[model samples]
Target: MRIDTRVEINAPASLVREKLLAFSEHADWNPFFTSIELVGCDIRDSDSQVKPGDRLKVSMKDVRSGKVSTFTPTVLSCTAKKFEWRGSLIGQWFFSGIHTFEFLEKDDSQKCVLLHHETFSGIAIPLLRPLLKGTQTNFEAMNNALIEVCENGC
Candidate 1:
C-alpha cells in the first residue's frame, strides 16, 4: 500500500530540507519519533550531506505500540528536494517499507510531504493488514507535530 501525507511548515524549502535531512535531529520537532538512537552514522566522502548508500540505525517509539522499535535504514537517495530510504526492522521482524520525503514550494510558503510505500509479502498479509493502519495514524500525528514546531519556531 501507498500512503501520501503533506504538511505545511512556515519555513522555506531550504530550511525544511535542512531540518528533514538531519535524521538524528528529529527529536527537535518530530512527535512520533521520541528519539533517534543512532547505532551508526556515516556520511559519504563526497560533498553530499546524506548519500544514497549511507545507513543510520535509529530507535523509534510509537504511541500505538507504546514500545520502541529499532531499525537500520539505508539511505537510498538524498537531494535538496527529496530524501529516500529503504528500511528493515533490525531486531524484530516486520514488513519492509520505503520512506520518501519531498520538499515542495507551495505559493509563499513551503510544504513537506512524506510518502510511505510498503509491500506485504508471503503469508503475512492477513495479520499485517491491521498493523499497517498505524502508519496513517502516525502520519497524522507527525503532521500535527510539524505544524506545532514550525508555528512555535522549534
Candidate 2:
C-alpha cells in the first residue's frame, strides 16, 4: 500500500526544509509526530543537520484512533531537497515501509512544493489492511499543518 500526498506552501523551500528538519520543534506543528528526538547524540554538541547515521526517537499518534506509537528509525538519506528513511519494525519481513519528504522549489516563486509519501510492502500488509484507516487523511492533515507553520511562522 502507498499513501502519497503533497501540498504547496507559500514560503521558500529553504525555510520549509529548515522547518522540516527541526526535530525538536515538531510537536508544535507536526500532528502525527508528537515527539522527535535525536538518539545517542546531543543536539547542542552534534552537527545541526540531518545525516545518514542519525537515529530518531519518534512518537506518532494515529489521527483516527488517537493511539500513540513509538519507534526509532535511522536516517537513510538526506539532501537539501529530500529526506528519506526506512520504517522501524521488530520483524522486518512482516511489515516494512519507506517514508520520504521532498521540497521542490518553484522556478520563479518562493513557493515550496512539498511531497510526503510512504510505501508499505510486506507480508502483513493484507492482514493489517483493516487497521489502516485514515492513512491518506492523516498525510493531508500533516501537510496542511506544515503549510500553516511555514506561511505564518515556524
Who wins the TM-score comparison? 2
Per-model lDDT: 0.64, 0.82
In the range 1-154, model 1's lDDT, one tens digit per residue, is: 5677777676677666765556566777776766643335554443337677777666666757776777777778788778777775432145556777777766665554433333334345557677777777776786676666655666
Which residue segments of model 1 deviate by more than 4 Å? 37-48, 89-94, 108-123
How far does residue 15 in candidate 2 sit from its true spot (Å)? 0.8
lDDT of 1: 0.64
Instruction: Enumerate residue pairs that collide in model 2.
Output: none
lDDT of 2 by residue, 13-120 (tens): 888888888877888998888887778965554223768877888888887788899888778888988888777465668887788899899866589899999888
Worst 10 residues of 1 by lDDT: 113-122
TM-score of 1: 0.76
Error of 2 at 47 (Å): 7.5
